[model samples]
Target: MADVSDPLSLEWGGRPARGAPGPMLAALEPAAHRYRFQQGARRRSSVTYLDTVDRRLRKKGLSLRYESDSDSEVLVASAPDGIDTTELGEAPVWPALAEQLPAGSVADRVGPAMWVRAVAPVVETEVVSREITARNEDDKIVARLHWQEATANGSPTLARVSLDPLRGYAADAERIARLLADSGEFVVPERSLAEVWLRHAADDEVERRPTITAGMRADVAVATALLGFLDAIERNVAGTIDDVDTEFLHDLRVAVRRSRSVLKLTGDALPERLVARGARELKWLGDATTPTRDLDVYLLELDELATRLTVGTRADLDDFATHLHWERTVARRSLVRALQSKRFERWCESWRQSLTEIVSSGGSEQSGSVEELARDRVRVAYKRVLKRANAITPDCPGERVHSLRKRAKELRYLLEMFAPVCDRKPHRAVVKNLKRVQDILGAVQDGEVQSASLRVFAERMLDRRSASAATLLAMGELSAGFAGEQRQARDELTDALPGFLGSSVHKRVTAMLP
Candidate 1:
């Protein structure tokens, strides 16, 4: 392919009338070297734009499409510089993971961006087009033209006629472009066909963060922030209900958890009844999602956990893996039912409308701005974490460390929500410090929980006769490994906690507060 550095340098798209050669092509203007046209019957085709649940491919500056005609399916990847296409012998089922694609450039390009997430059809459009070949007297094709029109979700889009100039046909291209420009029936569009298709997609809103402004009202700002989280929950519902990927459900649960934390930490700015009800409703959502999410985590990590074994081979966990899948199937049924329930549906709607109303109503003149509220909240939460950290000793119960972890999490959320108001460098510095501590905390927590959960799983497997004796023994070894890993993480925490507890860190945390 030649360099199309400027897509508009050729003024190619024209809205032509039916049956005629098209306003741009019909006028032969002043070209002595005439071109003949061969038109084919119009046909229908479809292209489905696919990406990770998080829109990772879009972020990486690429587009992948599964295009289908009457018989064959092809996967196409396009960027500004060029395009690559590969034929898929057959179309894979939807909600496809990046790693599942056959080995090729397209898979290699998308795999890193997708990480663990699955790719699904973000936008699907059907197009009908008439193919026209413009050729010289030698019957050598000079250009390929398509009178294409598309519809997405039953609405029309990309309604235009376009021409692709063949190599070594510069004179014909220039002359045709001049004719179109002079006719004034065609104008240069800023976006390409793919951009236009994605523009109308419902999932185009990838950035979930609410743009909270400076000096916003306390209650209104909190509501706005919470609304963003609520939007995320609603956005992930369809994917989660469909079980598109574990990440979809994971994202939904994170949003729900964030919403709960915000209400618990800053609900005083809003009415007590509203805060109470919102927290209660979100708690139900969180509980409903927890079982499936827990199973998803184990299933996703099963391969890695199996790799860590010396006492048993990877094949030993085959029965254990099967048991997990069976449990997850049962758990997902309950989860999907809850997600599709009227209670869940009604809560999301009421939650959004209520929050939006509060935001529209504005805060009282007597109330402080969000920055002020953030300062108070951050200050209090930081001290709580500090107090808890200081109280943790070498032999303190696991509950104490867990308490500290909770306080630290609340502090982290406050920092993130109010980050827009804080100094950029200071906020990043504080978050960096908090994230380090949080990582160790997470290790400790996951270790204890996973170890206990493994024992329970082992018991259930035995009761159901679903596991071999070898698998049960392997699970015991895995549980012991988790216990050891937890011990190691605690030791790391003991060595690292003092740095975070120091005066310089406190100063940075204080400075980051709005």
Candidate 2:
């Protein structure tokens, strides 16, 4: 990995006057046609060189050098804290420039004919590292690099770039070659390049301005924090099972769920693979903790409700509690087995790999407008919630519905997160409708849980033979009442969903988000 703490300068290419090719052109022609400019503080100085290498002729390696375009010579550095070629990729520097290409010109022609120069002050560098271990039958090396650098001044000047194959040279070589060839003819306008670099310079000044919305800051902060948190969780899971602290594990599970929910609710601003893998890990963690958590909840409820029962009912409750204890014991054992399972270990490994890809893909650094990203995330979340709601099974336990309700809440929260940047009225309306859906689901789940508890008590009394005919009759009546409540709750939930979604308010909200 390049040192990010030193100052650096990078200069790429520009068309020389028609009369003669300049020294810079002479330096660049032998190398790849594309060039990159980077300059800034220690960690912030460097230009990314994507697809600059030709793989077909590996024996002959190509490297970039800066030449004097007019007066000054292009400078390159390898400071422990300076600029390096770790950030470039195949994505066009100026996407809109492509549209401005001349007839028959492969590259887009836009902006200034003058030279391109880009510079920024370094803020930070994120590094991901791993060790290679010999397994039963496989010898593999693992390495990853993902980083974000912000300008010295707190501005929206953060750039995330993925380092090319840090381990597999052959694979990376081939990939880079293919990317360059496939990019066709591409040209970047000097003005656009200058604009991007200038944005970094103005970052500090912008931070001082009051017009900069708090919502934008919050969104960036949350997204950055999430990336770091997920990285930590992935590392812990991959390296050692013992490292998985209960609280940390639980929090990671929640974070994954929350991030996914937020992403879905807002619309997928991030990459799909990251969101999908995070959701998968969340599900795995949920499953791993389910038995213990479920038993814990059941026991708490049993203890609380037992005290409120009449003496005869108490007896029934006691028998039910005993059965629950037995079930809990069984569940605990099952949970332990699962935690130690080879499958679990493999799942963790897979998750770590997926997370590595997401972190290193430079997906976070793409050029889309932030507002567009946020709106997309909200839309995605809404769709996910709707799909989950529609998929609810009658046979699923009350706990399932409770989980779904929680998901709905997350989606609502995400929509609210985007309300400021995008239109809020529609999001507000969607939230209102979503709240109705959540309330109905909540009621249904509550009724189901209560009814299940009552059934457990009834079965226990029948098994123990401790109750008289009168006691049995009373228990039967209680069970019948609980069942009625459960049915009513379900009916309400079913009847209310369409209205909640179809209302004019919901339609308005959907329009806003979309």
Candidate 3:
């Protein structure tokens, strides 16, 4: 295994102006005294690269592959230069490993995009490799050069040179690159193999998300940000349709929710018709995804949820788990069907079609300093949350706290959307406060959801006869546990409210509005 962080090679090539890899290497032979070139063996093999539907691995400068010639089918993770590899272990079947990579750096980095995205052979090319060792005057090896010609599916595709220089021999490598360039042997191909494969495979490129500035117009800024998110939503729809990972639906739901939030937050600035239509369609989209996502949440948390019971009580929940799993599977099927429907396609098209005129209709109504608008909105939202928080008593209904939670989320989204344009210190302070409040409220809401879910599951389990009496009893105890936690969260709000709505944070919020 090679050290993943260490560079195995360096390379520079331009368009192949003339001749093949052999002639290119032969051209460099004239300077044999300074570069003693010894020809190594010729090797040939087919290499296949794997990537997400959207090419997430390639976008992050990583390439994953399994070389057929290797003894083991372990997926080798490598950089673009094909030098070092981080072996991700072997699976009897390639796609099986998709569910096997743990939640470590590799998973965290690319898992969200690839969640449910299938890993298949995206690029397959027969590569003929020629190796040459360049030695110093003392006959010590200085650099290793490889010339490779790749033919995709029996058709000549591309050729390039790679230089693997020994330690302290970087200068020698650069000289070699210069010599190759001066001879017009090969043109420098700007894209990697993965990038080339992506271009050849599909006409799509990764959508660039927004980074708003203080100077942009309000309507344009909002539209720009929303459009970026919409693009992501469209891209992930296919993966969601395939039910590849829980994240596909998760991301799609988030984009829809965020789109709705944008419309509510900037309703006055955007075109009235556009806002109305977006709200309606986005609402429909969000509603369609809710059942699946809710089911996903329960399924994802099942392990942790099981731990809320005692050692002996854990087995009792098995029947309940089966019931939930069956329901989740059914919910997943419904969600997949919805994503694949023509109505969903039309909705996406309608949303995208509205993009062109979203900013045009506002005219003078939307004209304002974006920074001022952001500040005013953030100020109002924060104050509303503060008022709502203050109104809450220990005896207040759960609905009041839930409403306050919604307000806090609204405020947090506004601050986050405008963060690039806002003052760092005050913006961060307000966001920090908002997050604490949101977390507590979220806990409160989650507890309620879990308790309600347990009751519902209990009834369904009884009807289905999937759950035993022991499981039902365990669920009752679990539901009580959630109720207790909810009470504790509500109690903590007394202390949490003073800090979140304190004079200092209030002053910071006011200062941030400037």
Better of 1 and 3 by lDDT: 1
TM-score winner, 1 or 2: 1
For 405-484, candidate 2 gives per-residue lDDT tens digits of 87687776666545555566766666777888877776676666666765665666678665456555545555665677
**lDDT at 82, model 2:** 30
**Candidate 1: 10-residue stretch with minimal lDDT:** 1-10
Clashes of each: 0, 21, 8
Alpha-carbon local distance difference test for all models: 0.80, 0.44, 0.72
TM-score of each: 0.84, 0.40, 0.76
Worst ten in a row by lDDT for model 3? 1-10
Clashing pairs in 3: 13-187, 13-188, 14-187, 14-188, 15-187, 115-245, 116-244, 116-245
Structural RMSD, model 1: 4.0
Q: Write the per-residue lDDT of candidate 1 for residues 353-396, one digit (tens) a residue.
A: 88889889987655579988988999999889989998877677
lDDT of model 3 at residue 193?
60
Candidate 2 runs further than 4 Å off: 1-281, 307-312, 336-370, 380-410, 413-433, 449-479, 490-504, 507-514
> Candidate 3 residues 134-220, lDDT tens each?
888888888887766666754445766677789999888767766666566444555666556656665434334555666777777
